[model samples]
Structure formats: structure tokens, C-alpha cells
Target: MAIVREKGAMRQWSRSQRQCGQRIALVPTMGFLHQGHLSLVAEARLRADKVVVSIYVNPGQFAPGEDLDVYPRDFDSDVEKLKPLGVDIIFNPHDLYVRESPEKNRESGHETWIRVENLERPLCGGSRPLFFRGVATVVSKLLNIVEPDVVVFGKKDYQQWRVLARMVRDLDFGVEVIGCPLVREADGLAMSSRNVRLTATERKNALAIFHSLKRAEELVRSGETDSSVLIEQAVTAISNAGGKVDYASIVDQETLKSVDKITKPSVFAITAWFGSVRLLDNVELSNN
Candidate 1:
């Protein structure tokens, strides 16, 4: 596999692949890859002739007090994991991938941002205000730079996947945004890079997020429709399991806005603090 670290090199590599009639698949990620990321790579391998993975921890997606400085990094290990996956090129750009302009830094000038209006203000957005703006902008840049035939994202980030899909459609980016299934551990925890930060006890407590979501699913399946009661029960389950609850509520699956009554299909999203690490999980309920 070829490792291209600079923007110029990646563009050149992408052009060469296109000239050869090789369809390109791009998997954008922040480093410290796990099984979840590899699943996306595997899906890319099946969908396109050439797979390119970009490993850059985006600073814009992180909030002021978030774990930007402390986010994990292990390029050597990440490469080892990708080498066997048949990835053709790895785009690991320098700090300049997306940086504040000198003028912007000097006087707090406005940095260019991409926002999906209604979709960016709910669910995770309620807590992390600037998260999707950073995500949409970086993803747009990656799509433009790589010019891939398709880009893959995990369904674990359901809202993100939806936002990107909408952004691509609205902006007329001629690349298919593919959403893969969430890969989970044998014990049922959704695979995440942040799982490494959990202490032994915290790890045990983290399972509450999944279990509570499961409970909510069971209630919905049994014909219960009260959104308030369902959310209260899920939050109670998480707290009983020793997690500091952030928010657990049901929202319209498509719009992501909180729904007072479950007249239609909805998604239940839960976020909680297991020790100091924040974790999120969701379940989709549909009649079909």
C-alpha cells in the first residue's frame, strides 16, 4: 500500500488511479483505528477498485474543552491494520490540512464553515454546538481532494452519516456516501476509539448505554408509545448501572428533533459519562 502524507501527493495519486480507470473509495478518519474503522475499509474494498484512507484528527470538530489535545494517535499501528486490508493509498496530511488563516487567528476573523441547518441543531448538536459544522466542512474538503467514486462512513455516527448524505446531495458532489453497519464488540458495546480511555470499572458501566437502548427497544416493540416515559426508563437504567447520564431521548428518525409522541418511527439516542469518557449509542424503531 502507498502512504501519501501531503495534499499534493494524494491528489497526484488519485489522478493516476482515475487515469487507469480504477474506481476510488475514500475512508476519512482520525487515527487510532479499531475494528469499527476496519469494517469501513473492508466495505470500501468490496465497492471500489482502489481504497484511500485519510487519517487526520480534525481540530474543528472538537469543542474548546473537548479531548482535542488528548485524542489518541498511533500511525504505525494504524498502518499495520490497514496494510492487510488492501488499501491502495493512505492520505495522512500535515497540520495544514485545515488550519486557521493567519488573518483569522490575528483578529478572530471568521473561518469558513459548512452547516446543514435543521440537521445540525438536534441530538448531538444540542450538546456539541459546533460539531457538525466542522464535520461537514472537513468532509467536503476530503471529497474534493480525493475525488473518490464513493465515500464510506459507519452508521454508529448515524446523525453524521445523515448530515453528510444531505450535504453531498445539496452541494452536488458526485460521490456516493455509503453508510455501513455499526460494528460492535462481542459483549455488545459499540466499537469506539474512546473505549480505550475507559478504566476497568468504567468499561463495565459503559455497557449500560447499550442495555438501556435495548430496554427502550423492548418497550417500543411491546406497543408502548409514550416518548417521555420511554426516555425516563432508559435514563433510569443507565443511572442504576453507575453512569452519569447526559441525555436519553427519542427523536424523529429522519429529522432528529425531539418528539413528544411516537406517532411514527423514531430513534432513541443516549449519551452518558462513564467516568470522564462520554459515550453515545442509539436504536432505530420502525414498523416495517
Candidate 2:
């Protein structure tokens, strides 16, 4: 249960592990651990000899009025939960994007950023314009700092997983990116740190997101290949359940472009707002 808060220490530890011929896996997180996050840790544990879990709430990922200030965080609780799971190191850096100094913390002076281009332009990217740019830049920093053999991400953020995978490939990162299945609560609401912020009624209303996707799945299975029909149905269902639909898209799984039909592998991805909390969920669709 070693907790590392500095990049140099983390890189040193990563180098030491490599010297011992140990394979390392990184499970980057924003703290406030839930079962969904632990699932990623479990996958990381199985894939590599050492697991490094990062718990930094990246400010760069949030826009002007987003939940960055109020995002849930419980570092001590997170450590206690991961202790039982055999996490080798917790890379909880104070701030990875800024330069640290005693007089005053200042910017890193680097204006560069990474973008996966097309994959980030739709869905969540459509609403949160800066979201993927911030995500890609910070994740690039993490990959460079940890230097793990592989990195794990939850498919709950389907676009994010795709974006990072594309970034790793385009930038020639020497680490494998693995996306685990999206986990949900018993009632079908996708597990998220922001789930705690949902009021009782809002939580109950959020079930429509899951049901909408399930209905979309049923439609696709029952010969409804029209992408517009699926998107309309999903949007209507969520809106009727007291949630605001952000985007209900049926897009090609790889290119992430909205498709006219389910001619190839595709995913029905949805993002909606339950109260002030924005949640994402998706279902893989194929004409079967």
C-alpha cells in the first residue's frame, strides 16, 4: 500500500519494477472509488504483476461551469477499499498539470495537447467541447509518468475509452489500452462517482437511461436498423422520465460517426442529465 504523490517517485518505482522484469498495469482514476472502479483494478491486477492506481481529479477535463469543484473525493476511503484488493501503489499526485512551487503554484508553460480527432467530436464531445482535449492531454501525461505495460479504462465512458485507445495508437505509446465492461447497479443505473449526488427521485428517474438502451437493444434485435429511430426513441424515453437527453447516438464503434443503419458493428451511446449530474451509458448494437 505505498502511496506516491510525485511523478519522479512514480517513474522511479516503474523503472524498478521493469528492472525486476515485472509487468505493470495502471488504473487511472479520479478518486471516490466505487465498485465500477474496483472492477478496473481487478482487471489490472490480473493483467500485470503490479497495479498502480492514480487518484487525481484532473481539473483540465472540466469546463467553465462543470462539476470539477464539487466532484466527490474521499482519498482515505479510497485507500481503505483498495487495500483489500492488493493495489501495489497509489499514484495520487497533487497536481499533474501545473508546476509546483513553494512561493506559488504556476502553470507548466506547455500549451501542447493531444486529440484523437474524429472520435472526440461527437456524443460527450459535442456538449463538453473541452472534455476530450483535457482528458487526452492528462492521460498522455499519466501514460508518460507511470510508463506501465498496460492501462485500464471502463467502457462506461465509451467515447473516452475509444479516444484514449486512438491516442495511444496515433502517438505510438508503448502501452496497451484495455477497456473493461461498463458496470451498473442492481437497478441498472451506471455506476458513477456522481451517482452519490443524485437525489432519491432523480436516482429513480435515472433508470430510464438503462431502460432506454435496453429498448434500443430490443429494437435492433427485432429488425429496427434505422439509426434515427433508435436515437429518437432513446431521447424521448429519457426525457419523459424527467431526465434531459444530451445525445442519443448510434455510431460506428470504431469511427464513432453516427450511422444510417446497423450495417456494421455499432454502439448506441447516450448521455443525459439527471438533475445536475451528467451520466453516460451505451449498448453495443448489431443486426443479429
Candidates' TM-scores? 0.93, 0.96
Look at candidate 2 and give me any clashing residue pairs.
none
Reference-based lDDT, each prediction: 0.87, 0.92
Clashes of 1: 0
Model 1 spans > 4 angstroms off:
98-110
**Candidate 1 lDDT score at position 47:** 99
How many Å off is the CA of 19 in candidate 1?
2.1
Per-residue alpha-carbon lDDT of candidate 2 for residues 39-77, written as tens digits (9 for 90 to 100): 999999999999999999998889988999999999999
Query: What lDDT would candidate 1 get against the real structure?
Result: 0.87
lDDT of 1 by residue, 218-287 (tens): 8877887888888888888889988988778788877888888778878888889998788878888653
Deviation from native of the Cα of residue 227 in model 2, angstroms: 1.5
Q: How good is model 2 by TM-score?
A: 0.96
Superposed model 2: Cα runs more than 4 Å off: 100-108
